[model samples]
Target: MRNKPPSLTESQYFLLAALLDGPLHGYGIIKATEQATDGRLRLAVGTLYGALDRLERARLVEADHEEIVDGRARRYYRLTNDGAAALQIEARRLQQAANVVIGRTRTAEA
Candidate 1:
């Protein structure tokens, strides 16, 4: 198998998860993350954009399109294939870690 990307931070993971369904603009991602986390992951505009910049550099996400809305420019982003794989790998890793803490074994799966 190919090498997997490094694990994502909670913030990065949340941002990636927000893009699982097609593409979303920066505001949409911020709102979606907060809603998904029950208002726990509220992101300021600066934080959101900063994470976006890093994720873009890591090739985990890319701008899919842009729009001019009410005299403002909005850029929408989509998760790249590599990003999806990283998220899946991280999810499985976390699940295994959780199972260990819960004293659940592999055979628990039915």
Candidate 2:
């Protein structure tokens, strides 16, 4: 039997998803996640950095590059191959869970 991928928290899931398109700086990730969730999740600066640090340590994400913008260093992060696989696994898990509710709701209505 295949080992199941580890589960992700909501913040971790969204953070990784934001990197799906490409590498993004901290602020870019915050904006992408907020937009993706329709402003439901606004990540504080500390929260964002904390999550990034954890993700980096886990090897799910990496610092792609750093650049100077307006005299400040901006770091860009990209999802590693393992990150993508984990994200996909989480997505499937969520979808299956949702389908159970939807199916039950439909049956009850019928």
Candidate 3:
């Protein structure tokens, strides 16, 4: 059976994070993710597109429009309301978990 789908994958988190500022084309999303992660998460073209497809189907993202970039067609995407909500929830969860670790480390040092 297929697993539950509420949980966001790392790729999804990064993608959604990139869109939090505004819409972006595939390459823009790739660059944003790389820059945000300080070059730690370079996504291959196929992987980025595949993740975009999944996010689109999940209603977490939507294609804004298509445009030509140096004779190649590029599609822009933006996060939906659901996507923003999911991203916010995931970020809060991560922040809370991080606080626990930080508190433990500080206590041990004290």
Candidate 4:
């Protein structure tokens, strides 16, 4: 039997989702996540970088490239195929969980 993919944390899920469009630098990721969550998730710089490091090590994400901005190096990260697959699995899981409650609510309302 095939093993199920490990579940992702809320922050990790959002971080990967933020890169769905394309590669994004640190600040871009932060902004994208915030916008995606409608400001509900504001990733602190330290937390962002820490998660990025862990994701990188897991091979779910990689440093796509780097650029020097104002003498500081900016690294951009991109999601790997594995990461995309994991995200999809997590999304479906979340939908199914939500559906359970939604189904109950509808039944009660009827």
Candidate 5:
């Protein structure tokens, strides 16, 4: 089997990370991602949907179908096993990146 594609942006990272907990609909995912990033990331509707489409195509996230909420259809998403594994890899990559920065910052301060 081929390896999963790497995350291309912070938004992609946020998307995968948000789904770490469980499945979420479009709006729920968006809100969770924004909050997780401390409001540093706010996805427009188009952007959010676009990312979802790409991720679903990649087999990372799958559409769980529509749920009626307040008399409206909301598309939900659930991470696949591959998606969870990918998220783990990305998290490790991010933690390593942070470690490098922290180490350098400490050395600079010292």
Candidate 6:
């Protein structure tokens, strides 16, 4: 049996983070993810599209509209209210986790 996917993967987190700033097309999302991760992550077209499809299904992300860019049709994506709220919660969770790690490291040094 195939393992069920997590509610949110790191890629999804990055993609949602990108939408936090504004809506973006596929290529734009790829670029934004790269920039956000400081080039640590590069999303392939297939991977990016797959993530978008799943997010749309979850009602977390919606296609705003198609825009013409360089003679190509680009579908822009925006975060829905649910998506924004989810991201906020995930961010807070991560922040709390980071604080714990920091506290551990500081104690180790002391």
Q: What are the RMSDs of all candidates, in order?
A: 3.7, 2.0, 3.3, 1.8, 1.6, 4.4
As for candidate 1, its clashing pairs are none
TM-score of each: 0.88, 0.95, 0.92, 0.95, 0.89, 0.89
Could you tell which candidate, 2 or 6, scores higher by TM-score? 2
lDDT score, candidate 3, position 107: 100
Clashes of each: 0, 0, 0, 0, 0, 0
Candidate 3 Cα outliers beyond 4 Å, as residue runs:
1-5
Q: In candidate 6, how many Å is residue 38 off?
A: 0.7
Model 6 quality (TM-score): 0.89
lDDT of 4 by residue, 1-110 (tens): 03466679999999999999999999999999999999999999999999999888777899999999999999999999888888999999999999999999999999
What lDDT tens digits, residue by residue, belong to model 1 across residues 11-102? 88989999999899998999999999999989999989999999898899999999999999999999999889888888898899898967
Candidates sorted on lDDT, descending: 4, 2, 3, 1, 6, 5
Best by lDDT: 4
Residue-level error in angstroms, candidate 6, position 9: 0.7
* TM-score result, candidate 5: 0.89
Off by over 4 Å in 4: 1-3
Taking the tens digit of each residue's C-alpha lDDT, what string does model 3 give over 1-110? Answer: 13233678888899999999999999899999999999999989999999999988888899999999899998999999888888888898889999999999999999
Candidate 2 C-alpha lDDT tens digits along 1-62: 13455678898899999999999999999999999999998999999999999888778899
| Candidate 5 clashes between residue pairs 3 or more apart in a chain or in different chains | none
* C-alpha lDDT of all candidate models, in order: 0.90, 0.92, 0.90, 0.93, 0.85, 0.86
Total colliding residue pairs, candidate 5? 0
Cα lDDT tens digits for candidate 6, 1-110: 02332368889999988998888898889899999999998999999999999988887899998978789898899998888877877888889999999999999999
- Residue-level lDDT for 94 in candidate 1: 88
